[model samples]
Target: MDYSYSEHKQCYVALDCIIFGFDRKDLKLLLIKRNFEPRKGDWSLMGGFLESDESLDEAASRILSSLTGLKDIYLEQLKGFGKVDRDPVARTISVAYYALINLNDHDKNLLPEFGAKWFPIDELPNLIFDHEEMVSLAKARLRHKASNQPVGFELLPDTFTLPELQQLYEAIYETSLDKRNFRRRILSMNVLEKTDKKQKKYSKKGAYLYKFDEDKYSEQKNKNGGTKMMFKPPKV
Candidate 1:
């Protein structure tokens, strides 16, 4: 039983990733200089066309791994862009996903091979196509997520100081945080375990290092009816 579907037009589907990393102080986005035509040599999000046999999540994972040599990364599907002329080469709809990676973990060598570079979120260059809009949307989502949850930990090292953690949040929010209030709020969450080790690089009296207690955090969240831990900024 063959059905004739010649009357309808088909468009290509692509997965575009807004890969974000925090370099201790500033939040950065991973962008590639497109190697192929339609917009060759222009800055674009890391993306690839969805294959027939894979789901959107799988496609996004594959693209990220191929570019960064990373796996099991923190990824979230953002939204879809379906403007008819978004891609001049073809009628295409792109499903955007944003990924957070610890800047210290990814393979630095792989970036050059793909002509990829990291740009600070605040000072991004002109991007090709609808990519700029995708970035804007992803940044908003990231800010909201970070404010309501501990997802920003994905962008930090396993063990970090309170100052480091606060800096990461400040970078994501693009503003200054009141250090005393920030520290007090985060400590009250009781999801961080203080370790004996101290980070001595920055101070005469080293700051204690703390690690996120994921299991404890999960238990607390479950007990609280799955409510997300909030990290709201203090009133100025």
Candidate 2:
């Protein structure tokens, strides 16, 4: 086999994080005000160059931890943005990763150092470079991920109600789902355990609380033949 150096060119690869958190019944994104030149003082995603000694996951963790004092978050590489003119100063390709974290679990002081701020997804301002596109993709991925995987737990408290869970989905999907059907579908999955507790914050009737059933979830995965349910609403 013959190799041609001309067929390939060397370029810098960077990792950008689209850190997502849920709060006040809304979806929010973690954004940093760029402190370096080329786009200094502009809003952008948290990003850094991939170092030679680290794997992609390691580099992502390092970058996020450095900016927000966070580690071990639900991180997954989204995709690579590799247009020749993406970066004005250099030929750099950026691999974006979307991370999920419970708003109550993260450090309260993560914003001071890098000028970080959590902005609601709908109210996001114009971002520098290709970050705006990355944010849009991350939001769509978040909706798909929450539907199929249990990753939404990363954004909720250890204990939650069915309504709380439903609201989380509604916030991400931006639509109201029928309460009865939502509960039926989720309960039918056999992956959630109803608890002895009830939450009364939203109504006087109060709603039963629930937690994820990790063991049954594993078993369900193995079987993969359980009855699938969908929520149906009564006439308004």
Best by TM-score: 1
Write down the RMSD of all candidates, one decimal each: 1.6, 3.6
Return the TM-score for candidate 2, rounded to 2 decimals.
Answer: 0.88
Candidate 1 structure lDDT: 0.91
lDDT of each: 0.91, 0.83
Clashing pairs in 2: none
Taking all chains together, the TM-score of candidate 1 against the true structure is 0.96
Cα lDDT tens digits, model 2, 4-68, are 89868789999999998888488888898888888889999989999999998899999988876
Q: Alpha carbon lDDT of residue 119, candidate 1? A: 95
**lDDT at 62, model 1:** 98
Q: What's the C-alpha lDDT at position 42 in model 1? A: 90
Q: In each prediction, how many residue pairs overlap at the backbone (N, C-alpha, C within less than 3 A)?
A: 0, 0
